[model samples]
Target: MKHSICSFVICLLVCTGSLASAQQANPKYDKKLADSLKADAYGMKMYYLVILKTGANTTENKTTTDSLFKGHMQNIGQLAKQGKLVVAGPMKKNDKNYRGIFILNSASMEEAAALLNTDPAIRHKLLDVEIYGWYGSAALPMYLPYHEKVEKNQ
Candidate 1:
């Protein structure tokens, strides 16, 4: 009898918990806004993912590499400012040929390649790039603003 009562109480709690959560509205939920942004559906779209790999000259020259990397950062900022790049970051502590990645706003591989070529690191052959078309949330473009809010030191 005691076990039966405990099981009943547990089931009641679980069902009520699920019901309460289902009734709660997400803070950012707005149907009109979503429709206005053309994200009413699954909000999936094609984007280019550029993978940066260790180049032939990646670590061959430290001084030149430092300068090229500085220019690379500048290029990243420029692309972000132009809304051409959705996200970019370097991989940490990896021994493989992997270096970094860029999620580009472009749908065309040619365009992505052209934009990537603008980087001094790429231009000077300090980094090699491979691009692929990816389908993901159209809401991804909205992430950067919210990301800036919680970022401490940029």
Candidate 2:
């Protein structure tokens, strides 16, 4: 029984030591990391979250629809390039009125409204937008570069 206890203690120590080593600070955890993470600022910043709902005008003209969609994508790219848009994507499920979402970089509702106005989908009345101010991580601006690196397709 004494021999078994000693062996168990030894095994526990070895496992804990390995675990502690694995939890050590990463080598690249430095001032740059803190700055990149915006750790010095407040925990959250104000942004606008726009929920796109299906508009009243849903008449299907394939060519017009395609053109508007292409223009919508172009507008999204442009907004992202200008840093006005943090993230935007469509919802997969169509059961609800909720269509897609846009996370805008502005704290002002008017600014978000102006940005949404530029989207062809919204302009053409293919999609109606509802904007709400959101408080979220200030680290969101840092996600784009990482997204670009990991994305397999365009």
The top-ranked prediction according to lDDT is 2
lDDT of 2 at 42: 50
Candidate 1 structure quality by residue, lDDT tens digits, 1-154: 9999999999999999999887766677777766644463555677899889987774547888888999999999899888789989999858777889999988589999999989999988888888999888777878877767998985
User: Model 2 shows how many backbone clashes?
Assistant: 0
Residue 99 lDDT (model 1): 89
* Candidates' C-alpha lDDT: 0.84, 0.85
Candidate 2 stretches with Cα past 4 Å from truth are: 1-41
- Residue-wise lDDT of candidate 2 within 10-85, one digit each (tens)? 9999999999887666556455656654554454678899999988778959999999989999999999998889
Report the Cα lDDT for candidate 1.
0.84
Superposition TM-score, candidate 1 onto the true structure: 0.71
Write out the backbone clash pairs for model 1: none
